[model samples]
Target: MSTGKVVLGTVAGLAVGGILGILFAPEKGSVTRQQILDKGNDYADDLKSKYNGIAETLKEKFQAVKNDAENIAQSGKAKFDEVKNEINRPAANY
Candidate 1:
């Protein structure tokens, strides 16, 4: 499997396991519920941070790729124009 899918699956599994553990603990109902809430919040924040970082990285990479493609296209156009000019130049007869 791809690394991204693996990471996502692992995170999901951990979250589910945490919730189940809290639910089955010997603590009082109110305490268990509170613990589950707190853990859920923590996991959500962690996932959000990871997701934001990944998104920012991808955004930056996309911009870089776009700029490179633009530069290449411009370079090719300039070369094409140069060749066309050479072909159209008037040549003196011998």
Candidate 2:
């Protein structure tokens, strides 16, 4: 499995376990609910961070690939122009 998937699964498992433990404990209901809510918020923040990082990385990679492609196209065009110029040059008189 992918690292993201693994991390998500682990986080989900831990969240569920925490909820179960809280339910079984003698703690007040309000505190347990608050803990669950806090954990959920934290998980959401983590996911947002992960997604943002991935998006930034993907954008960078796309820009790099686009730059390389443009360079190759420019080089090809230059070579074509050079060849065309050579072909069009006048031949020496007999």
Name the best candidate (by TM-score). Answer: 1
Residue lDDT tens for model 2, 33-84? 8877887788789878988999999999999999999999999999999988
Query: Could you tell me how far off, in angstroms, the CA of residue 83 lies in candidate 1 after the best superposition?
Result: 0.8
After superposition, the stretches of candidate 2 with alpha carbons farther than 4 Å from their true spots are 90-94
Q: 82 in model 1: Cα distance from truth in Å?
A: 0.8
* lDDT (tens digit, per residue) of candidate 1 on 1-94: 9989998999999999999988888999999989999998999999999999999999999999999999999999999999887777744322
* Candidate 1 ranges beyond 4 A from true positions: 91-94
Query: Which pairs clash inside model 1?
Result: none
All candidates: CA RMSD (Å): 2.1, 2.3
Q: Which one is best on lDDT?
A: 1
